[model samples]
Target: MDTAMQDRALGAVLAGACGDALGAPYEFGPPLVAEQPVEMRGGGPFGWEPGEWTDDTSMAIPVLEAVANGARWNETRTHGRLLAAWSDWAQDAPDVGAQTRAVLGRLTANTEDAARAAALAVHEQQGRSAGNGSLMRTAPLALGFLGDGGKRPLAVAARRVSDLTHHEDDAGDACVLWTVAIRHAVRRGKLDVRRGVPLLPRERRTLWLDRIAEAEHSAPADHTERNGWVVAALQAAVSAISTGDGLVDTLERAVRGGGDTDTVAAITGGLAGALAGASALPEQWTVLVHGWPGKRLDWLRSLAVRAVDRTPGPLGMPVRRS
Candidate 1:
């Protein structure tokens, strides 16, 4: 990838984390009024430190790690590794989505089959599993699959990965669509959530296209009440990205929608970051963003690049301890 494309790829990961941290304090809070001030204030129900990311970004780290290890995303071994990593992380995660917590907590074995079965059981038990948890962690998967022509592999891999913890077809479809959109934005520097609609199952394309259109024409608030659902969450993220002028403003717009503020903003951040590039992220937010696995801003930067480069060598990104 060229420097510009690389920068956008880096942005997708870094800005997603930054957005997670920036919106952390506002999660489940009332929607902000238009032009209301926003900052990385932290101290939400989970008591996150200022600039500390939540599970949205924390869950993405395993995807990045799998890509950096050169693991093919569709393989069982790859799924096993991701499941094991997530299981370990959830053991102490301050806040995990109810759907994710249920699925991950039920795992008695860390294998891919076990994870999938657990996910399926949970979905059957509840009769609904279309949660935003899968989509939030899906951005990094796109970077790993950018090399595949036609992006077919990218779509398949996205659904497979989503299925590990989210059995709902809507959740899997959302991942495929958003991941494809992120891949396109990084490659072309444009925001088009609809760019991935054609990649959806033939029966589902028009439905997603209409959803994308609805998001474009609506405000983020339209989806905030149900943003925990994968489709509504995707809509809120897309609405913010399509309506706002830039990455920061888009994230702010997402936060203003309230409810699952951090998840919505993190979702918006991945696409906005892909379009605007890492340099477009605010220095203030980037400097303070930190999260699970002892990751700081520098680790996320390196992980983003390494996932794209698929380089297993020494860290290419400079280490900046915050």
Candidate 2:
């Protein structure tokens, strides 16, 4: 890949991580002005404090690692790698959702029916929950499988990885849509979610809506939250691109929009980064973010090259000859 494309990929990764770290401290707050650190602490609560990313990015890293190492779809090896990564992150035990933590705990115990039981428990308790967790970690799937000339194969692979924990049809479908959308955005530098939403086909959309409605209907009556809010995240991402807004603004809107802040910010930020590239990010924010970083930034840069370099052209050949 050329320098420009490489930089774009790196930018996407950095943007995603930076967004996650910046939004972490204010995951649950009001829409207008979410609580952040005091200005004396660096003009923001988490600023200058070496922002720490949560499970959103943690889960994504292994997905990239697995793809880079050539893990196949639905394979036990791939699933095991994902589980092992979750285990490693679980050891540190950062602030994670109750449902996610419980699933991880069971997986760690090495129980006989750990995987099945965990999936069932999440589905039962959450009623086929379709949160943004699946979408947040799906960027790599887009980057990894782009131009592979097999959307079905790629979607199946990405879905298996997503379904390791989130098995709901809508969640899985959303994960696929987000992944493919990012791939197109990164490659072409643009995509229309509104246009793409309808392209999902009636049957598929109905399937997704069904699962979402099931989760919503099964949800306690006290729950007034809208499951369609997840679509709001997708809309927010598309709006960021259409309106030419910066990554931070887009991410802030996603987070403050409420209901699954981190995941929404993560998915939105990932798409924005892929569309806008690293240069689109604010220099000050990038410097601050990269300053405290390790392989997260470096891997992002490398993966960007890989993303462009891997796109296949006519007759399954590489489109751009490096």
Candidate 3:
């Protein structure tokens, strides 16, 4: 990989961990004004120690690990390992979304078509199953696709990964767009939040454009950007990226935006960090934040770099020519 993309990949992972840990202490609480620059304090509703990341990064790490280990599109080995990791994590993860909890529960108990069966059950139980569950951990999918994939591979990998725990069209669609945004930021040095619109199905495109409009132009009174809803989370994270002046401030804005704060901030951080590169992050923040799966920032950085270098996905190519 070129020096620029490599740095951006490193930036994505570190800043994501940083944002996840920074927002951990204030997950569902009212947004707090920073009396000072944000710190990675623990003890949110989950109550882990300082610098510990939450379910957002915990779930994401499995994907990153599998990708770094060379898991590609529709590859059962990676998916199975990810499922096993989810089952193990359920035993002790500090927090899990309702959709993810349901899906993982079924995956643990049954071996046949676990992802589809679990999602089908959830759909039957609840008329709709759209949540931010799958979207939060999808960044690595993009990194894996960066080698020889384009819009089609990205869309396919995104929906398939999301179906493991979330089945709603909106959730799957959000994952595709967000992953594309991350890739765009890494390669091009900026986010095109609407890049997914042209790639979306016709019906979803119209709905999404309307949704994006509401989210993009939302005033605080509108409350378009808050909570576990996939649309709100996507909108909030993208809006924060578009508006903030730098990586740190962008993350700070996402956390202070309130409602599902950690997820939103982590998502935003991944995008902004990719565009800004690791140098954009505060050194102290990277030094403090880490994965609960026992990965420090440097470990996460290496995993991210590997994901970009290997893991060609369905296309079978390297990230760059040697």
Candidate 4:
């Protein structure tokens, strides 16, 4: 792989984690007006430590790990691995969305079918399963499926993975759009949320196109009230990435968008990182951002690199900081 593309791949996950940690302290708070300083101080409602990532990046770790290890999305074993990893993470996760907790809690079997059934049951019982939980963790799927032929597989897998915890069509649609867009950004080094609209069911294309246009025409905070929903969450992330002047500003716009700040920023960071590359992320945030599985900057970068290049290395073995 070309070095620049590889750097963008690394940026996809690392910056995503950075965004998650950066926004953790501001989650659920009221929207911040422009010029309000945003920092990674990390002591929000969850009482997270400075630069600590939340469930957004935590849930993504297993997906990255599985894909890096050569797990295909179509395999029941792959789904089982993802479910088991998530079950383990949720056991002590400082903050997991109620929708995700419900689905994972209902998993009596570790198979893909069983997970889907559990998710479907939750959706039926709750009457809504379109939370942003799935979208927040979707960046890794894009990284895993990069290259010329990665789009179709990525789309299929993104929906299936999202369906594991979010059974609603809207949730699945959001994942497909975001992951595909991330893949495109990683390959082309540009932002284009609408690039994935063609992957959606024909009837939903125009609706999503209108939504993307709305996001482009407005600011991230405009979606805050409903940012918990998958569609609005994607909108907020897109707005931040499309409107902000740079990587830091893009993530800050997402955090400022409010309500589910970590998730929106995490989602934004993935695409923004792909477009800007790992070198574009502020070193201050990268140095501080660490999370579940006892990982830090190097490990996150390894996950992204290994997922795309499929090169063998000590995945997360610590080494001296560069």
Candidate 5:
């Protein structure tokens, strides 16, 4: 790939991570509260201090690791690796979302019905709690499956990975749709959410509508609360993208829109990063988020280079060596 494409891909990854970290400190705060400038929280609720990532980036780490190791879709080892990543995060005990914490707790207890219990618990407590958790970490999937020449396969792979815990069809579908959008934006160089939403594939379009309507009708009016609403997360992401603003602007918009702010901002930022690249991110924000484990900007750059190398070039040709 040319230097420009390489830069764009790297920018996308870094921008996504930066957005995740920046939004961490204000995850479930009031929309009005988030509108106020954030104070440096050192590493946040975690010991790492300011700019550290939350569950959003942690879950994504496995996706990138799996792809980097050349794992294919539906591979048992791939799924194991994904689960292992979650296990590792559990050991670290980061500031996890309530639904995720409960799920991981069951997985750690080694209950015979752990997976089923986790899925059911989230669905019952959070009402199909897809919650943008999977969406936030979906950028690597976009990178991995780019140039595969079909969106369905990639979408299916996204669903499989996310369904491990999210399970809800709506959640899985949102993950796939967001991944597709990010990949398309990265490859095509821009995205206009209002224009692009209508053009999504039929399945994705239907899912998008269902999710948005759910959010509009059911999302709590309060801006500072966290209800684990997946639909609200999707709406906020779409809103941020439609604004055509810089990373900080988009993230602030999403975060302030309330209901799962961090997750929503993280997901929106990933898509925006793919659409706009690192330059779209403010330097101070990037520096703040550059060093968290599995969330470093430089590491993301390396992963982006590797992912691009895997893409097939023109005329079904192999990717050309730089």
Candidate 6:
């Protein structure tokens, strides 16, 4: 693996975990701007300890695990492995959402058909299932498919991964948009959220493009976004990054948005962390913050290295960022 890609990959995962743990203490609370320099303080409503990340990072770990050994995005076999992983994760993790539980609850070892059925059943029961649950865990897909070709291959991976649980097209759009943006961030050290819009399916592109504009132009507080809706979650992450500077600044801004602080910060962390590299992450948190489901920082780093290195590339990869 290229040393730079490895560092950026590590940065993306570690920073995301850092943001989740940092925002945990402030989850669903008032703005924490005054409480700047957010740390891995934990102790959110979920009763997590300091330095323990929430479901955000735990969910992504499966994606990294499933694909780290040269798994292609298009293989149906890959979805089966991911589903089994999610089933295993939900067994012990105490913080799963109701929608996710309902979807994954109906699955067995064979998951693709079951996932689709469960998604439809949940959607019918709830009247809507386009939550940020899928989007929050999608960064690993970005990492897994890093340099695997271009926008469309990564785009397809995003949709397939999102469809595994959050099957609604809106939720799929949010995942695709963010996943591609993360690809840009990790590859180029910058996240152009708009860059992914043009690559979307025509119908999905319209709504997603509008979402990007709203996120870019609106006030951070204007969205009043919780961590539920994919659009709202996307807006929250983009708004926080638009105004905040540096790693801590951006993450703190997301946490200060209050409701769903961990998810919002986590979303921003993947993007900002990719741009900044793992070395840019604060050493204090790096020493303390680790993931759940039996994953540590070093383990995740190895998975990320494999995710980037073991994957194959497209015939004519474009000239994206370095």
| Per-residue lDDT of model 4, residues 1-322, tens digit only | 6778788878888889999998999999999989799999979999998999999999999989887887777777888989999998899887889999999999998778888899999999999999999998988887666654677778989998998889888999999998988888877787788888888999999999998899888788898899999989888988898788989989999999889999999999889998999999877888898988788877878766677666221232221111
The model with the greater lDDT, 2 or 5, is 5
The predicted structure with the larger TM-score, 4 or 5, is: 4
* Model 3, span 167-240: residue lDDT tens: 78888899888888877777667667788777788878988888777767752213433458888888888777
Backbone clashes per model, in order? Answer: 0, 1, 0, 0, 7, 0
Error of 2 at 179 (Å): 0.6
Cα shift from native, residue 5, model 5 (Å): 3.2
Better of 1 and 3 by TM-score: 1
| TM-score versus the correct structure, for each prediction | 0.94, 0.76, 0.92, 0.95, 0.80, 0.92
Q: Name the regions of candidate 6 deviating beyond 4 angstroms.
A: 35-37, 312-321
Full-model lDDT, candidate 5: 0.63
Cα lDDT, model 3, residue 194: 80
Instruction: Report the candidate with higher TM-score, 1 versus 6.
Output: 1
Which has the higher lDDT value, candidate number 5 or candidate number 6? 6
Candidate 5 runs further than 4 Å off: 33-35, 38-48, 108-127, 192-207, 210-227, 290-295, 311-322
Model 6 residue 245 CA deviation in Å: 0.9
Q: For model 5, what is the alpha-carbon lDDT of residue 3?
A: 56
lDDT (CA) for every model shown?
0.86, 0.57, 0.77, 0.85, 0.63, 0.77
Task: Tally clashes: model 5.
Answer: 7
Between prediction 5 and prediction 6, the one with superior TM-score is: 6
Q: What is candidate 2's lDDT per residue for 1-322, written digit by digit as tens?
A: 4555555455556677767666565555344343543111122232334455666777777776666555565467667767777767767544555555667766744332466467667778767556556667777766555554645555666667666666566666676676666666665666534223344546787654444344333311111244233444444444434443566666665555544455556676787787777777765555544322244455555654554455432124443422
Which pairs clash in model 6? none
Please give the ranking of all candidate structures by lDDT, highest first, separated by commas: 1, 4, 6, 3, 5, 2
